[model samples]
Target: MMIKQVFAILAVFLLFVFPSASLKNLTYQETDKVALNVSASDPDKDAFSIRYGSPLDGNGQWQTAYGDAGVYRLNITVSDGDLSDSEEVRLIINRKEEPPMVTSLKPSTDALSVTEGRMLSFSIAATDLNKDAPRLCLVPGRPERFWGEGFFLRSRLR
Candidate 1:
């Protein structure tokens, strides 16, 4: 009876120690819609895995599919004699948005407009990647290096 109880406790410990519900395997085509590269890893080596929309469950072992363009779901499952479980992962396939273009740069050429009246001033244009408004920065020439480039960047000037 004591041995039986110890065996039961060991079984329960093993069952809980290793997370039974396998964290699903997934390969998103990049949520940004650029392209998709398959990446995956399994601790328990669950048999069922979906990579690039190719189901690898049969003797064929590996197959390839040109998954649809959009959010994709790769469902995963694990079974170990006593119990089984599953989970779904998300992958978004979208076009890669180009980085914003620096269309132009307008510098003051003269520092009279600046409070410092240092006679060295400038301005520029910047665009954001993904069309999500742009950000800018200017690094003024350090005092030691007065002969400098954009020490002050005026952001959100668009």
Candidate 2:
């Protein structure tokens, strides 16, 4: 009985002295070039295994993409057979800002010539690398004569 009491006290002391596994939350942008490295540590010098949910590669890294902007809950756990620790990591992925590119302008010339009572038409093409819809609009407070025939043009690129 005395030996049992001594072992019990030793176990309690070990619990107070040794620390468990720990992890921290992360936030990243979808356009970030760097990879997200999920790291955890155990101070007991025990062989442990880490378990994290999807979107993480084999090396426990994540390379974000354009459409990956969202909040994720990762249940990360580390276990050393007898003792284990778990953490609910909140990961926030922010959207990347990208501007649209004008691909081409029809009538590809600095000047346009038109005759009286003749109809004139031109077009503009644009694209967005982020897969966002593109919108075309003339600058506000422009001269009404620039838009002859009271026509306004707007186009969306797929």
Candidate 3:
């Protein structure tokens, strides 16, 4: 009967001395640097071994890329030989926005004068570093007669 009581007490003690792990979800933009360190606690001060189930360097650093915009599941485990704890963290990567750049504008000068009932020609070129499509449109409330052929703009003044 005494041995049974001692065993019960030891069970409760072991339960209170177990190790635990904690981690939080993270969010970042593309091309941003990421660094994360696992968090764990052990009452017995035991040495812990950490394992990452995702693509993280030894120092828990990752350099995000342009095409890496999405949600990632990070599985981390902390173990002290006999006991182990694990945590699942979500890492979100967002795409960065960049404005389109005008590469060239025909009739280099900003303004030009054309006689009435005459034809005028111009062109505009632009590029987007993010591989997005570039659009060209006339300003609203402008009194002009023009048609676009790709990036080329041809106009006739009445």
Predicted structure with the largest TM-score when compared to the true one? 2
- Report how far off residue 125 is in candidate 2 (Å): 3.2
lDDT of 3 by residue, 3-25 (tens): 11111000101111121222345
**Which segments of model 2 are wrong by more than 4 Å?**
1-24, 33-46, 80-84, 110-123, 138-158
In the range 61-142, model 1's lDDT, one tens digit per residue, is 2222232444446543433333344445444344444556666756534232444646754555766544557777655654
- Order of the predicted models by TM-score, top scorer first: 2, 3, 1
TM-score of each: 0.27, 0.55, 0.50
User: In candidate 2, what are the lDDT values of residues 1-158, reduced to their tens digit?
Assistant: 22111110001111111212223446667754323344444454556666556666544456667868887776655666665566666567777867777788887764455788888777888887667889887543335324433444444444
Query: lDDT of each structure?
Result: 0.38, 0.55, 0.58
For model 3 the local lDDT of residue 29 reads: 75
| Candidate 3: residue 121 lDDT (0-100) | 72
Off by over 4 Å in 1: 1-91, 95-98, 107-121, 140-158
RMSD of 3: 11.8
